[model samples]
Target: MNKRKPLDERRAEIVEAGLSVALREGVESVTVRRVAQEAGISLGTVHYCFDDKDAMLRAMGRSIAMRASEPVIAALEAGPDRRALAEATVDALLVGLKEHQEMRLLTFEFAVSGARTPVLREVAQAHLTQSIAMTREYLQRLADVAQVTWASDIDDLARMTALRIDGIELAWMVDQDDAAAREGFAVLARDVFADMRPELPAG
Candidate 1:
């Protein structure tokens, strides 16, 4: 007999399966039964993993968002200056977005689906709130690394970060122009994050 996976592991597996199904077949096809088929597990297994379709989707949305940020978060470092830090961070971010284009597109689909699908509405709302909160934390971490503080409210910066990222991902997906995306990131580093420039120690 094969050993059963742990609960958390199983849930993660199901989340991946559901994402595959959604990305492959569209969000409407992401029923528990369909995800179970994709995962080669029984429908009951999916139920055990999630109380219902909404719950499963919530898990999937959260998983996708977490993965989307991992690369950029890993790239954050103390640079010679604030601009360098911003460039490094957003460059890693652009790489991640291009690398996982499908995943990034799926988030856009979910946002639209949330408008039409009642069950997905909460998932969409939750994701926006989650993204903003997570961005807030990331901004704080970046500031800590740079030994600086934002001249503006961190919450506002977090909201701006979340919206700008969403815009960048969508624009990149449409254009598939790496050069333009990099150019935009450069601009963001200069215009947006310049607030942290004050932290450079006086010579």
Candidate 2:
């Protein structure tokens, strides 16, 4: 008899299959049997990894959010000046969105699931909170590094910026017009950052 794949590997495969199904046919189509068929595993195997559809959906959401944030985090750590940091943030978002179109679809499906399922809702809220916190930290770090002060409310601005990013991502997923999406995001970022320039000393 062949040895079974490790539990972690099996779980990862199931999640990937679930994401594929959700992206292609929508979340309602991602039943345990469907995922098992997609992953070439038994339904029991899918159950062994996830408690139920809700659990699978939550796992999928977490995975997509983490994968999408990677490039943004990397760009922030690239030691760029403030303008570069701002542009990198926008560019990273656009590239990540374009590269992970399927993941974005899955994310939207999970969000809709959250509306009716408490567990999924909690998971979504937690993920959003974590994302916003990370955004706030990155913005604060950029301000400090560039010796820029924000005359307006920093926390409020950060939250607004993050929400704008989330909106742009969802819009881009549907529109798939990369040039238009990038231009819109660039304009938004430029306007936000430009408003703070007077707070910094002359370069």
Predictions in order: lDDT: 0.82, 0.76
lDDT of 2 by residue, 41-79 (tens): 899999999998767766777788778778877776644
Write the residue-wise lDDT of candidate 1 on 1-203 in tens digits: 97999999999999999999988998778998899999999999999989988889878877877888887788775453665677688788888887788887888888898889887898788777878898898888888777777998989988987888788778988888888888777776665576774655545
In candidate 1, how many clashes are counted? 0
Per lDDT, the best of the predicted structures is: 1
lDDT of 1: 0.82
The TM-scores of all predictions, comma-separated, are 0.90, 0.74
Off by over 4 Å in 2: 116-158, 187-199
